[model samples]
Target chain A: MTQTNTIRVLVAKPGLDGHDRGAKVIARALRDAGMEVIYTGLRQTPEQIVEAAIQEDVDAIGLSILSGAHNFLFPKVVELLKKEGADDILVIGGGVIPDEDIPGLKEAGIAEIFTPGTPTSRIVEFIKENVKH
Target chain B: MDLIQSVLNGEKRGIAKMITLIEKNAPEAIEALKQIYQHTGKAAIIGITGPPGSGKSSLVNQLTKKIRSEDKKVGIIAIDPTSPFTGGALLGDRIRMQELALDQGVFIRSMGSRGALGGLSRASYDAAKVLDAAGMDYVIIETVGVGQSEIDIVKLADIVALVLIPGMGDEVQAIKAGVMEIGDVFVVNKADKDGANRVVTEIEMMLDLNTEKDAARPPVIKTIATTGEGIDELNEHIKKYWHQIANSNELAKRRKERIRSELISITEDHILNQILSDKSSKIDSMVKDIYEKKIDPYSAMELLIAPEK
Candidate 1:
């Protein structure tokens, strides 16, 4: 009855941000760390991201946005997941966002935020620790 | 039971959760498969396979849009390779099919091949069944960019379309003998690129070598998957193949063959798993016995398989 446990994470880019290098980096990092990562390439809407997360049945969704629209876009994805009754999917963010935005994003249900120069291992570790089964 | 009911109710969440569990081979999968198997065997499964960097994903996207225009519901299973070192995978096929992600009529799932060498994970076949039981009109599977011997898609799909792109290599290397022999339909994607016509000619030349005179030649269609060129014609060719097979009862024959292979495989897995994992059978002791040469491996297998006999 024992089956292998696989951690599935969706690495996505939301909004007008054309910057996807960060998302790709985290995706490759997560994969190299033994997690199945699905990368939805650039310019995904919150709705599309949520829909994909549901279909993929991923344990966590790491939303990477550098368009300075993180405040609006991050909460929108979290809200849509809640609306779809899939809020159990852990939502996290990473990018070039300023220091003032972390607390607000965290309050909006984002589990954590990784800013510039953070090692990819920390993000991978955070996903493994926070996945809700 | 509730998940089964929800899946039957066409709930996406339910279907997705069930597919994940079935892929993992959880205990509940057996009962669920029993309930769902009867609901399957109706949807057409089409496999789009080809070499790396080819336009298989884009073709799937366009074909899906074409099917959706007819008001048919579609389910897509796109498989990608897992890294051997980390047992992890990056399923990026969805990036090319982004337009279909939010469409209510389409359900797209990306799967990691999970060490299966035949271009598909075992979970992918089960996921296709989940989609079929959930009432999809067509299920489309896109295999990881394939090479020779990844032709496993041919055994499961009702129709197999082998896609090739120009400028990859000489025709001999590009047209792998293992895959070239099985395609029901052929595609020259990126037809707008240079050397497109040469690729077409090479396939035509290859097809002419077949000695099966009664079999109609599979059509070779040219396509530029990015700009949606020649997709309508490709879809028509696929439909024509389906119609021809259905009229000849070849569809039933293929399904019967598929079932025969699948049943044997499932039974083999079950017996081998039980034999190796059963502690009460003294599997560990048998290992020690073989190591000490007290029993040969073949005798050990016979003893494990039928102790009383």
Candidate 2:
């Protein structure tokens, strides 16, 4: 929509969770869908994620948290981005998020939450449709 | 074109743009680097690596300050982990050295690991070369402190400083033998903490046990990174080691090895990209077969290379 060539996305895993099969799958899927995805690997902190988003000038940040520390980590990421005046960047999350906690996460400025079974196509479409730049 | 020319002339923004281009893995970036490659190799490259919570960023920040105090321009590449979902980076290390961001003499860039195993990014060596050619007095690379994989830093830096903090518990013991051997200097940070001395002693004992008879003994320095204690002494020791290496031809030998390593890494990346982008139906069918277990990965690879065979 913004006339950009590719939608740049930063896919990160926060805290100590080492499982990355899902993350890799999503990255490959996004790339296949003509998006530019920068996979940061595992064990990234909130600060590292924000700094990367700033430098990469990405359109969206997708945090995959399976470590149950989402409450602690996601807020910090949002806070840092806000502090850096990067609030315009879309923030979304996935990875074992519970149904009960979705509202709280959404209230914290997360644009969307995709669960484990969500199709990669749907994710790609959502990003392309919603993210302006 | 002017940007590329300025990069060749060793200007700061030009260097930053070159690194950004390289990290993007753009086609033109390679040409830009080739143009500037010959001007590289003047700066002292030091790698600061250790496990998370080892205070590597703080040490790098302090070292940058110390290096600048002596009127030396510094280029720092702090590698952060990339985002798995979005394929971006959360570069927290920049937060540690935010003050340096405002300094005209210091250039700091945070690079994402991009999931490249062995602790270093594929473009890191090239980026360092860009900094070196940019006329920085020193180039410091800080890695994400992830055990043995982090030892890859040794291949890129003239001096490798391993930072260890107090109260890491038994995690310190889990550092691989490869990491233990590559350290040219050891730092015990957070010296104000309770177990600082014990960590220092343990490192000393480990050094004594593992080092060769002819190898120079690596010095361990203690520091409270938050307050900048012991940083000046650490800088002095690092310079002392650098002078010794320069005078002994060790620096030249190390630089040769680093260049060789960079060539190998770049070639590997090129070959892999080529293989993936070759656009042959045979490779695709082979991958599908491998996924279906009709053939093993080794056989698939062999089949993919059958044209050359």
Top TM-score model: 1
Residues A1-133 of candidate 2 have per-residue lDDT tens digits of 0111346678888899899888878877776665667666678878777866665567788889898888788878898999977888898899998999889988998888999899888888888888854
TM-score of chain A of each: 0.97, 0.94
Tens digits of per-residue lDDT for model 2 on B1-309?
Answer: 786677666665467557767777777777888877788888999999888877888888888998998999898888866555555444557657755654677777766677676677877888998888888889999986676545788888999988878887664583447777777988889899998898888888777676369779999999988899999989999999999998898999988887787788678867776677774677888778888999999977876656763
Instruction: List TM-scores of chain B, every candidate.
Output: 0.95, 0.91
Query: Per-residue CA lDDT of candidate 1, range B47-67, in tens?
Result: 999898898999999999999
Q: Report lDDT (Cα) of residue B274, candidate 1.
A: 77
- Model 2 chain A, poorest ten-residue lDDT window? A1-10
- Every candidate's DockQ is 0.80, 0.05
- Best DockQ among the predictions, by candidate number: 1
Query: TM-scores of all models?
Result: 0.97, 0.70
TM-score attained by model 2: 0.70
Q: Cα miss at B45, model 2 (Å)? A: 0.5
Once fitted onto the true fold, the runs of candidate 1 whose alpha carbons sit more than 4 angstroms away are: B174-176, B279-283
Clash-forming residue pairs, model 1: none
